[model samples]
Target: MIIHTDRDLSLSGMETFTPKTFNIPELVGIGAKNIEEHLKLYKGYVSNSNLIINKIKEYEKDPVENVYVLGELHRRFSFEFDGMRNHEYYFESLSDGKKEINKDGELYKKIEIEWGSFENWLTQYKAIAMTRGIGWVILYHDKQTGHLLNQWIDEQHLGHLTGLSPVLCLDMWEHAYVYDYPTSEKKKYVEAFFENLNWDKVENNY
Candidate 1:
């Protein structure tokens, strides 16, 4: 991976994203090894993102000859970029140890308005997390309506709701729990994730 600080400027003199370090602590069901390996995957996304950007620059030197390759690279960029971003949200929410929810926060109040109660929202979100696929479950704040919505993304770059901002993200991929929990018991992993969640981080996202 390209290990560099945020101060490391790219060729365009713009800041490129390096893999972010999370201050995660011990959790209830998720093992240290699980997180260690998961962070490695996150770094791969970061690496691939930088690699793709550089390759695009290289290919653009002959935009005529390398048109096809450049086209494909452009197509693949979102997958890597979104993968990096989504994991940041997922890991950050679990970072800095676990913090309890602020019942008076806007996120909590919004959930109550949107779903009638916090429990209702959580029940629905957890069920959405159990969706059969390798992807993510996200809680998005609909930008236009200011309403909270739950969405199941099919992959890093697919099925994203346009104009909505993600407030919370949960990785539903087997890699998120394969080492600690079996496939059939993935719900336990979800429960464990909430057990150690930093709702304060989630509130910040909100």
Candidate 2:
């Protein structure tokens, strides 16, 4: 595992998350059954995140005696917390309704400034989503540099940029599409995800 970032660390008074509800419409390629199951996994992440924080609090009652336990719990918290957060980004993008990216938006200008054109960025981001593992393809905004960067995160925690925030998140975990596409045809699921995306929601995140 990578060294813990501030987000990966278990804080003394971390608050639990309430799983968010998405107003998702019928989507192309991706079936309703697939979405129903996906949301369940999202909820599991939220509950597990809460459980981990609560467990850390219990272990903290005896910091010296539970040092090892606390250490491991702190490390484990990031996976669950990021899982919850990443899904929120993914699901929200597919929520409300499908719409085209606004060419006039700040996000569009940023994409163009970084990659020369929106299509260039989309092509590269889609290729990144096809990375050979269960992970995420994220578009992050670096506040310090005022730049956008694409990153591939391994297992919900590793590879996140320090001091940056993800404006868009694509879950490439097999579970995200197991009900909609075979492993060999995951590209179709990627296509389906974008087909249903609400770029407005992603812009709001930025």
Candidate 3:
């Protein structure tokens, strides 16, 4: 469920996703065949929990915390992707990966140490499918320091903390869930978001 912003996802590519029956004509170009299709895809993403847990176990080689930072990433991606699909990617107004400093700009060494090798990171990045919501959790590269960091945000606002460019993002918000589950089942919805992650895509993103 944790998704790298990029990676290969032939089955879930932007080309094949269909839109819904009642969606506005303005949204036809947004992908999906229409609005109802979009909504279905959104709910389906929400109900993929086991995939989330298992994927998390697969991604963390170092094990920073038993707590899965990547799963949280997916939760955030769900929120962000839905907002964009709905043309709500911009609300209050705006928004915003890999590397380590002290390497004297050594690309190969940095890739090996900081990311467990470039190939591994690539595999880890592109595994998630569509997500829903309004907020975003992102991964970024601090261009100046050449290090990577993951951060969380509630809206488009930034600068509370400053760092590199965005490597990945996850959206989090209610509109993402209200359509699929009653407010009471928010926990259940969160639990079910692991079925369709595109690991290939995530690896590419990372």
Best by TM-score: 2
Tens-digit lDDT string for candidate 2 (104-166): 999999999999999999999999998998999999999999999899999999998899999
Q: What TM-score fits each model?
A: 0.92, 0.93, 0.34
Which sections of candidate 1 miss by over 4 Å? 1-15
What are the per-residue Cα lDDT tens digits for candidate 1 across 32-112?
A: 999999999999999999898888767867788998998899899889999999999999999998888999888899899
lDDT of 3 by residue, 57-141 (tens): 4554445663467658555544434433322221101111112222334443555676787655433432221223344455456
Distance from true location, Cα of 69 in model 3, Å = 41
Q: Which ten residues in a row have the lowest lDDT in candidate 2?
A: 1-10
Candidate 2: C-alpha RMSD after superposition: 4.7
lDDT score of residue 42 within candidate 1? 96
Selected candidate, larger lDDT, 2 vs 3: 2
Report lDDT per candidate: 0.90, 0.91, 0.41
- Tell me the spans in candidate 2 whose CA falls farther than 4 Å from its real position: 1-11
lDDT, residue 204, model 1: 91
Better of 1 and 3 by TM-score: 1
RMSD of 3: 19.9
The superposed Cα distance between candidate 1 and the true structure at residue 42, in angstroms, equals: 0.4
